[model samples]
Target chain A: MTGRVIVITSGKGGVGKTTTSANIGTALAKAGYKVVLIDTDLGLRNLDLLLGLENRIVYTIVDVIEERCKLKQALVKDKKNPNLSLLAAAQTRDKTAVNAEQLKSICDTLKEENDFVLVDCPAGIEQGFQNAVAGASEAIVVTTPEMSAIRDADRIIGLLEAKEEITSYKLLLNRVRPSLIKSNEMMSVDDVVEILSCPLVGIIPEDTGIITSTNKGEPIVNDEAALAGKAYRNVAQRILGEEVPFLDLDEPKGFMAKIKNAFAKLKAKV
Target chain B: MEKGFVENGFIIDLSDAKNTTQLVFELSSVMEHPEVKRKNVCLKLGALDLKQSQLLSIKALIESMDANLAFIDTDSEQTEASAVSLGIIVSEISDNLEPSIVCSAAEEVKDEEVVIKTECEVVEEDKTVEVHADLNSNANPIETAEGIEDIYDEQSTQELSEIIPAEHFEANFEALAESEGLIKAEEASKYILLDTGDVLPEGAEENDTNTETLPTLYINQTLRSGQTVSYEGNILIIGDAHPGSEIVAGGDITVWGILGGIAHAGSLGNVTSKVRALKLNAIQLRIAGLYARRNDTLNVPYVQKTNEFTPEEAQIEDGKIVIYKKLRRD
Candidate 1:
């Protein structure tokens, strides 16, 4: 069966591009759909570490492009999922080793067997970003509520619109904290969506468990109790043509907050 | 025709060099030898053409090593024209000429042509890297290997086979600033070896060619990310090697500052070559056929510019890569 080729990118660094790719790819595999995560960050690769498959990598994408190994040989199977595999990037090599055409050919070949092929792009709009977006039919623009992130996302969307291959594009708003937004300290989710003027796929709440999961080399989505994990799972379902509502992150917990909420609603009616 | 006589000179034969990179790399590696510091260098460029800019760079590179370009012999018409325009002499040495050494492999030289001989050739041309080294008219380095090893007494290979299999190793690195006693056991387990078997190049024979005998390439600049420095002999860096950078040497690698990249020592299969840095923070350490990586718990991104440096050294011992942490001063 043919697979859907999607590229997850962020124009700025440390905006959760690799983390999103690992979590969504795992969520899809857990749903029984075969997925392949291709890390296009050549010299500064972190996807393999996030998936806890660093020690198992014998060959990388550069080896495949250089004809030192077959494409299948370079694909390292995930530790938990049989259907999910990783085509890791060479940590010792740079972006100049693989050109856009070679990455396109690799994506073309990978989409034939897998149900979803997610490309984890490096930061910046230079050669690395161009190589990552060369063969994708869909794009996931990951951004935070900060002004710098929205500005870069807008620029990326403009570039994606110019490419004929990108049939659709959606925005993934990450690291959202409801308390900060309510206190007027951070940007609201609606402000980000309005600024970018792009359709939203999912909103990932700010969770402390993400840091622990990253250090443990386990994706946050695997933690069933994490709000960010549930949010990422909703995103995977939405990718599969299902309608999943956004999480109401502003809803306050605790007994005193429930009474306060009732009084606030009654006062609004008057 | 008889050529003008010159003293204290060397004829570097680059006739087999396939490209400019190979030519420059081979030339730089040999030129850094202390013996060739003041010697004039004569290059033999084969059929390969050289642009004026490329020739200028090569000339500048040779001058950087405190050597002079005496002349060059080239077969390519384009190279001759380029050398003539750059005011470089393009002429061949006649058979009647007398010098202390001759590297030209011609059918005409029949008499006592060479008083000096090549001290290199242990490095096989695997993935392209083989060149005749700088010649000295006086000393044979092979006989002096033992004496040179004595100079590096603290850095000696002390029972290398026993260092790896041991549960704990006594800290043996004597600090250059102060010689302190043994301290911690956890300091020696910095890198964990990989299980990949027999990673040596095809048809590569294991040998302990004295790394002291090989020439060194001294680099004085900070190596940024994505940059690589590969040499056929020992390499000494005066600055830091940033993450994402790679330094591949055919012999020992020494860095005066932090080494945060991948270092491949003895790339041609000389297991005795060592990798040492002011701060041994390499992401991956490779010695000859063995490979090891930093512990995952200590894999945090390298940052912070601190003045404190605990110099460490890594070498192949007992078929496993072992690290020795220098003692810290109280």
Candidate 2:
């Protein structure tokens, strides 16, 4: 079966595109599909570090396109999943070294073997971003609910639609606060999707553990307790043709119950 | 490559094809290969500006070869031009593939169109799901995993373990911000705003033992509800502070957008601090040791009764923080 290539991108930095790519790749591979996540950030390559595969990236995407190594040679298998691999971006090379055509060729080569190929696009609408999107069959635009990020996402959506890539585009809202939404403090997922006019693929709540995990070069999906982790996993499932409902981040928590649970956990640890 | 031969018919001639063996192999391969099917497979000979004619020929070749003939090329001008002609429009090819896949992938209990019909149903189901979330006010996020697992019961837990189970979080008090909400502290102001400047409080020292050095927090996004920002220094919110979000700074707080959230400036006991926003409708306002809340009573015209409107009038005169509709007219 031919594999699908999905590019995870966000025009703004720190909006969680790399995180989505890593988690979705892992989630898909865990679901039994052979998956390869490519970091196309080049100079700011972080997918390898995010997946903790930096040490295993024998060759980088740059090396493969430059003919220094084969595509398979550059694929670093996730120590956790033999089926999950990472094609790390070169640390020193700039996005100029490659073009969209080169990326398309690279993705084509991977499609012949893997079930899913996810490209972690660089932040910005520059050449690097172009090269990253050039090869992918579909796109996952990641953004936060903040108006600034949402506005950027809207710009991206407009570009993709203008380019006629809208049909294949999906949205992943990160760092969302449902409680804020209920209280009319933050934008609701519905409001975001309505504004972007795109299909909602995932909703990732802001989790501090994500920061800790990033510091450790581990994706939050590795932590089952993190809501963002499940959200990403659900995103992967959706990509695999499964229908999953979005979770409500704005639901009011039973304050007293939460306090009780907080005490329970404290008591348990003791 | 495709030029008209018999008035209405087209022909492609490969007279000078004898130049390269690789070209010969490629020509024969396109003609004879079963999977590499094509119509009017022909070559041409001439001063052929390989850039112009070869590019056209490759386009004709791909069009004739297969609807989805994925192209591969090196940096040669002709090849580059050929690739460009196809426009290598990434999304188009992918979208053309989805319908067929969606059709086959769709589990039809009835007819093939059942899939399309189900698509609508699925959306409706999504709406209901959201409605359900609304009804289940205190739905523990962890329970979602149990529901998901139950949906796919055949799969074992070993199959889908995550590194951080946010759905099944064991909340920590210090980490309460992460769970309850993230409070990014705003920046404090350099100079404090004093309502009663007559006499300093008994322990009113800007640099007192109780005072903590405040850090500058430059918040870039609208602080939405459930998001609280607390800092030891001044807070500068570049975006709107949503009604539900609160910013507590040890110094001063300034918002670029409408500030509807709670703002506490000089929480570290800096009595002279102030809070400012483009539009302020904070649920609770605190500065230094003073705190105030909007009064629901006394039909004080929502609109300004008179000209004066300052933080001083908004402060507590007697024991309670004062909420003056219009600066007490004389």
Candidate 3:
């Protein structure tokens, strides 16, 4: 099965790229597609941990590309989803360990077996950025509703266009808060879509579950009850050519939904 | 083609498999349209290939449909071959046949010494008017001809159409009235000069040494940490806008490289001033006194650290500057 190689990138670091990749990969795998999440951050790899497969990573992407191990040997299967896998980056290495061509070949190899290969790109448009994009046939720019993240996302989109890698790019607006958007304290998804000129792929709401999930080395998609988990599943469906509606960030809070949401939140907090 | 005709423009190839057949049809349809086919459309078709006949057919179809078909660049050998086969002259012609004809009127007068290509009346009708300035010198001659027919007075060179038609030219007179283009009128000796080749005056300044005085700020290299450049007029950055770098301009700000810094444009409270960049990602942007941070909330600590290094523009609206993506498509 020819898998679509998608690079999840944000020019600025720590804008939830790994989180987005892990969740989306898990979500897609849960949808029954054979998915592989390749962490291209190299030295600072966190996707394995985010997907709760860190301990299972016996071989890294560096090992696979460097011929120390085969691609299958380097792939760490997610315990939660038998179909999902993680090709962890070498934490001992830096962004320079790999290049775009190597990543492209790696992704090409994986494409023959997997339905989707998600390259979790390192933040910053540097060597690592080039390597991550090298293998990607499509790109998903992950950014928050903040001005800086949007700007960096824009810069990444520009570089992607300049490299002529992908004809069109998609934007994944993560960590958006409905209350903040309603209060005009934060940029709305509309505002971002207007400036970036890219179609909105997914809008992940601000959920503390993502943080807790990260701390626990489990992607939010593993938790079926979490809002973020459901959102990631929606994203996965959208990527699979399903016309799923975006998670309602602007929907007014109903008493029952709010109460259930609050109880869910309180239970998680406790 | 006259000066500025397809200068630095590319050729669009109509034969690409990746492009939708509908798009190719639309382009052909656009060429078939009488108005757009007359305009100088640059082509950059990359590796798309088409047979010579198909290209000629498209070109002729476009030329015949437009009133001003002077943009045809049939000089190249390949195009010349097609033009010969199509029975079309391989010369640059004005899109507006009228101005080209008027311009040619002067050329014919100047070239009186040489054998006239055709009778004056037929030349007038067929755009065969060629003028010669020097009668005695049999040396290289200046040729000016108009391909547009019936758009100008053949007898008197009073262009029936305004040099810049008042209807179409909503002159940026407010800003450029003092420019040489407007002042050239006053510098000329007469309010009206026919195709006699009376030289127009170099109004304002003949040399135009005022380029240095245009209130431009030149940034030598990429903007790095904590550096800021604020100007009342335009700001041109020769390098990248690195993270933590700040640039605030009352007018437009043009960044030549990756703009990964904070840029606040139209800071002088002008809504029209634009902030343009090759790559825009700003950490903090402020247009005028309005301010916006990369991420407004402290929820995501690690993301905030990266946000401080992102670049983008912050424009003022309703007394607040807000960060936005550099490319506003709608």
Candidate 4:
């Protein structure tokens, strides 16, 4: 069966594009769908490490595109999930090694065997970005609350619209701090949505577990206890055409908890 | 039988034709002529008596031959309406032509000349009415063309006002300066012959006649960081200017929303120019050659005592940029 190819891109670097790709791909595979993640960052490849499959990669996307090996020979299966696999990038080669047409052909063959192909696009509007976006039919732009990242995300959205192949696109805001937003020190979700003028698919709050998961070479979505893991699952469900409620940023309070909060406020006043 | 011939181009008179079928057959034969092929010709249809569908079919036939068609000397509104729908130009012969012979022959070339002249006049009137409607819909009162023309007329005798020079002032002045001089010469003669209104008294500054007019650019959206807008004239922004974004203007600058960026007004050294914003939390402000940074110590105590956010204005005073609370004028 043909799969849906979705590219995850952010025009600015260090905005969690690779993190979102790894988590979404893992979460989709956990739901019993065959999924493949391709790291298109070329020289700075990291999707293999994120999936804990770095040592298993014998060949890469560059090898498949160059015809050095068959497409199936380069796809390294994930250690955790049998349905999940990864096509790593060539760390020795640069972005120009694989052209857009070559990537398109490679994705076509991958689509035939998998239920979803998540492309982890490199940051910056360069050849790497063009090659990653050329193969995808849908896009997810990852951004933060900062003005610099949001501006670059806007520029990326414009470039995506110019591509005739991409039919649908959505935004995913990452690294958001709820306390900073409540204190008016940082921009809120509504502020970003208004400026970007795109529908938001997910909001991942700033969590320390993401760092821990990254160090362990595993996506946060596998932890099952982390808030960020739950958020990634919700995003995966949304992509599957399921209506899921967003994760509440504020702590959930019950009836007795509300009474305790009121008494605590009154005691502080005295 | 088609009663018309090809003089300058093909002319078909449909008055003598019996029915729509006969008209279509004859027009098809005219279009197939070897002389009409590969030439840009105006095929004139004179005084047709066919229905709208019949006219449409003839129009389609002419278009297939790649010839431009002009419907002339038609008395029926249905034929004219059909021609218009096909994007064909229509003209009516004047009353000077003989009524019966008007549709019978093509020798009376003088009537076609009169019809062409009247068509041009009708198109000109239609264009002016459309322009007037468009000018009324835009929101800016200053840029609207309503009283500005009257103001230009009333001040014709007075010397042109002095405009503060900026980088674009040279190009703008060269384009407008010569045209205004020519208008003044024409107006002076017309007013002298009419003997209306007093001319300007002597001793007015002759250099003022060449002053340039400054134009203001309006921006309606927020400017994010890494964006910079520089203009040779004034600028008015209706949205917020975020930090890291910068605006440089040759004259005054105004922001209707929050201003958190760097703004430099009167960059060309017009010291009187001012900068105003609804919420001025700018990192840096400059007017003319003087510059000032936001004083955190000065703002903290003021904000605590007032407990209300107030708008601010910045201007050059005593060769330095000073910021103060904006006072309501009205």
Across residues B1-330, which tens digit of lDDT does each residue of candidate 1 receive?
001113456556677889999888888876766555676677878888999999999999988888888778788998899899999988774323222222332112222122111111111111111122333345221210112212233333333212121111112222231343333336335777766655676666677987777777767677876688888877877678986678998888888788987788998899988888889888778899887877766664433344468777787778877776766522
Tens-place lDDT digits, model 3, residues A77-101: 7766889888888765678778778
Query: Considering TM-score, which of the candidate structures 1 and 2 is the better prediction for this target?
Result: 1
Each prediction's whole-model lDDT (CA): 0.77, 0.59, 0.60, 0.68
List ranges where model 3 is wrong by over 4 Å.
Answer: A252-270, B1-330
Worst-scoring 10-residue span by lDDT in model 3 chain A: A49-58
Task: Give the Å shift of residue B4 in candidate 4.
Answer: 99
lDDT, model 1, position B110 = 23
Candidate 2 per-residue C-alpha lDDT over B158-212 given as tens digits, one digit per residue, 9 for 90 to 100:
2221222212211221133222232322212111222322222345444332222
TM-score of chain B of 1: 0.45
Error of model 4, residue A203, in angstroms: 0.6
Top model by TM-score, which number? 1
- B183, model 2: CA deviation in Å? 51
Clashing pairs in 1: none
Poorest lDDT segment (10 consecutive residues) of candidate 4 chain A: A49-58
lDDT of 2 by residue, A1-270 (tens): 688988888888999998888888988988899998888887667776576654334357888887866677677778678999888887656788888899989888898899998989998898988888877778999999888898888877776666643359989989887667768989888888898888888888988888777766677887888888888888888888888988766444689877886887899999
When summed lDDT is taken over every stretch of 10 residues in candidate 2 chain A, the lowest stretch is A50-59
Residue A237 CA error for candidate 3 (Å)? 0.9
Ranking of candidates on TM-score, top first: 1, 4, 3, 2
